[model samples]
Target: MPDSLDPSLPRIFLSAGELACPERPSIITTVLGSCVSLCLWDRVRCAGGMNHYALPYPFTADEEPNARYGAWAIEGLYECLLEQGSRPAHLEAKLFGGAALIPAPQAQLDIGGRNVALGLSELRRLGVPLKARRTGGQHGLLLHFRTDTAEVLLRRAGG
Candidate 1:
């Protein structure tokens, strides 16, 4: 229920612009820096889903949001979970990643910050309650989400 990682569990790694809600229990995992990932758990179904996004907002707001941007990522992930039998009212969230990894100008860090901010705002707008978080630092993170129990183990990884 906390920070345990079982070696025997099946694991799935999500690349940027991807979202997943496995039919079976899995150790859904991903690595991130300057990007953001949302760990969404459905209480009624006892299932969970995850998403990884590079930017908080899309290039064009009206181009139909998908998993590539945070706005669409949140939308797509929720839609996927709903299609898989989860109720919007029974959902809770855990947020991860959004690190200032690159050594570019302030623009790079600003992007990371924007990712976190937008994620929080979007979830709020959609009425999803955020339960936990391990985001916004100068290093990357490795996330292991236990789909069966809807628990997560987050390790501060690279910088």
Candidate 2:
């Protein structure tokens, strides 16, 4: 909550299959490789959220849609903003992750590409303009998002 890097400011660490949108000035951070982390911010409300998903699309109807899937995760974040009285048109977006963690044939099962594309498509369909992004390559990422200021700090793993 404080401008300084106060030890008291809550730091939420998103695991491989987690997502959240908080009202307080909490810092959300996560790591990704081939997976995607989509961050959405509402400038008017000074609020933001992020989701970490492993896959771009849901495979079956029988499966319960989860935050681990981009289809659900992306919309879920949008819904949170709307619920907070933030208009869809007023929201800005930033996408991260979708790295080529594996060194195999980059096309056959390029899940990373799918993840980035899916995020971009959904944001476009929602009419939310994507302002920035860091995606693709053969490395994992360390992302820090400040919810209060909607500031993001990113770095490639082991860089």
Candidate 3:
């Protein structure tokens, strides 16, 4: 059996503040509620990555460079994969997150909804195919990406 963390087939764990990939097929995982995560894959090359971002920004502008946001998160993930030799044309996306956990009366603001919209728009601007998505609900999600097969598994909290 191969080691789970094998570089050629690594098991990457992406938290709210991280992203990762592998030279070969790998597994990338993250947790989210209102925040959104976009998983990018190059079907031809079998190379891809994933990102988890909180809001669109920590602040409107003048925010710290490391601030976690959809724009920066998507750019970073795209660059990382490209640097690894994945082409943009071959890129496909799987988007997840944006949950309205609070009751409707209190969940009016809907930052989660905003996150989902921003994520989709960003991906579209980059010309990536929006293959599938699971957004807008009252529950959190646990996502797992299988880079080898380009498979995504989403498990809803308490369901």
Best first by TM-score, ranked: 2, 1, 3
Please provide, for model 3 over 12-34, each residue's C-alpha lDDT reduced to its tens digit, 9 standing for 90 to 100. Answer: 77877566656767888788898
User: Which has the greatest TM-score?
Assistant: 2
- Please identify which of the two predictions, 1 or 3, would achieve the higher TM-score against the true structure: 1
Question: Which regions in candidate 1 have their CA more than 4 angstroms from the true location?
Answer: 1-4, 61-65, 103-109
Q: What is candidate 2's CA lDDT for residue 81?
A: 77
Worst 10 residues of 2 by lDDT: 1-10
lDDT of each: 0.86, 0.87, 0.81
Candidate 2 accuracy as lDDT: 0.87
TM-score of each model, paired residue for residue? 0.88, 0.93, 0.87
RMSD (CA, Å), each prediction: 2.5, 2.1, 3.5
C-alpha-based local distance difference test score of model 3: 0.81
Compared to the true structure, candidate 2 yields what TM-score? 0.93
Q: What value of lDDT does candidate 1 attain over all alpha carbons?
A: 0.86
